[model samples]
Target: MKTKIFGHRGSAGTHPENTMISFKEAARVGADGIELDIQMTKDGVIVVIHDETVKRTTNGKDKGWVKDYTLKQLKKMDASYKFKDQYGICEIPTLEEVFDWAKSNQLLINVEFKTGLVAYKGIEEKTLKMINDYGLEDRIVLSSFNHYSLVKCRQLSSTIDLAILYMEGLYEPWDYAKRLHTNGIHPYHQTINKEIVDESIRNGIAVRPFTINDEKKMKEFIDYGCSAIITDHPKMAAALIK
Candidate 1:
């Protein structure tokens, strides 16, 4: 199988990370999929963002925890704060908005639950319902650093895909993944090697390393026969794959 390229936070190297524009750019560049993070708002609405605190991504005016703001309040801040001079203001996108938009394209969506820190009550159930409502189970992959959250998601839906996200080296992670009922692993790019990739693939587990932006490293992973690579520059990776 051809190694797939998934846009990390939607072509984060070029566009404002996690915004709709970033996602659209990734699709336009022929990325096989897009990876994004999700956190619940103060009003319990699921939104696409990477940080627990809004101070880093959003305009400084709204500086606080994401859980402190309602969806409406979050929409008011500019998520494109870092690139304001270039892209202007971009609102934080809701999961519903992303799902609705995703229907227009044939892009696989990797939704990473931001539950490693603040465990949003009932987030797994709520997110699963939204995915079902959008009828996107086949195209979606749910991943997280929290193994407990992954287990919860598996319990809620037997058919949906689950991937474990980890940063450290593991002794035969495929075995651990099997025990957790997860079929995929998204490891920190630096933590994966040829043996790990080969073993995981042999065991029918997908191996996709995250945030790989270096050209040489991208080529190395592709050569290792990884199922996919999550990268910040989808355009560059697509060019390489071609």
Candidate 2:
């Protein structure tokens, strides 16, 4: 089980998360794939920002970013504007834009579904449609902690691979993925160990851990037979691992 470099939120260590610029840098570093989170906006538009309340990720003018506003409103807020003095003002991009860039650049993408309490209103359907629309069944990996979202995706897209993202101390999760017909398991960085990873591998399930930036930690993931390792610094990890 050789580990490949999966960029977390598109080289977020270098730039803001879920942006075209960040993803481009990640591709420049030769990441095997880039990971991003998705949340739908008020007008039922599926955008690529992570938080349910967009206050943290975007520089919004009013109450919340995505909860009350549509993609048009989201476009006005500069997600990286606050960091302009530091990293410069970069605006938030939609999922369509992200996928377009990734597909054109021949990059693999891991899109995480985050629906907040409201469940992003048909994001799974939209995502499945996008996968088909972009003809990215082979290049994109759809993942989510929400089993319902993943299940919907599996039902919707026959070819687009699905990964069930879980955190530490999860009990008997493989049974769930099997039921959902998922292709892989994506776990948090700290919780994965040699035993679980090997078990997953033995079952013919692909195992990938998320957001691992530590070189030694990544070495351990490789030692555990993880299929892939998602990282904030794919450039650094790719350099060190080679």
Candidate 3:
């Protein structure tokens, strides 16, 4: 089977990470899926951003926690100004906006919940409901480093696809996936190997390794038959695969 290429943070290497412009660039480059991060604002609106704080990606410094800012406050900051002016004042998009784009474009989205550090109390339910409202249950994959969050997501919606994200090597990852009732495992690129990829495939679990920017590593994972490779340079990976 051909390996899928998922744009990491919506082609983060070329565009401002997690912005709508970045996601549009990923789609333009022909990526199979787009990976993004979701976190709740103080008003409980889900916003697409990778970091808990907006300091690094936005014009503002020391903006405190993402959850502390209301959507109106968060939207005031320019998400793409730090990267380049060509991106043209990209705003941190709401999950609903992204869901609308994804549904219209028929693109697969891997929504990584930024719950590893702060457990946003009803994020799972809110996220799931949004996905359902958009009729995108088949196209969305909910993934997170916090396994407990994935479990909660599963408890809320059994049909939603869940992937466990971990940075360490796992033993019999497929068994662990079975226990969690997840459909996939997302490992840090450095932790994935041929054996684990093969085992995951054998057990019918998707193995997608993340943040691979190097062409050599991308080729290696493709050779290992990963279900997908999540990378900052989706165009490079797509060219190499072709």
Give the candidate number with the greatest TM-score: 1
TM-scores for all candidates: the values are: 0.98, 0.93, 0.97
> Which stretches of model 3 miss by more than 4 angstroms?
none
Tens-digit lDDT track of model 2 for 68-143? 7877888887877334667777877888888777667777889998853665677788888887898888888889
| Tens-digit lDDT track of model 1 for 8-119 | 9998999999999999999999999999999999999999999999999988474899988999888888999567788988989999999999999889999999999998
TM-score of candidate 1 on Cα atoms, chains taken together: 0.98
Error of 2 at 222 (Å): 1.8
- Model 1: lDDT of residue 237: 96
Q: Is candidate 1 or candidate 3 better by lDDT?
A: 1
| Candidate 3 residue-wise lDDT at 107 | 77
RMSD (Å) of each candidate, 1 decimal: 0.8, 1.7, 1.1
Error of 1 at 174 (Å): 0.4
Name the TM-score of candidate 2. 0.93
lDDT of 3: 0.91
Clashing residue pairs in candidate 3 (N, C-alpha, C atoms within 3 angstroms): none
Ranking by lDDT: 1, 3, 2
Pairs of colliding residues, candidate 1: none
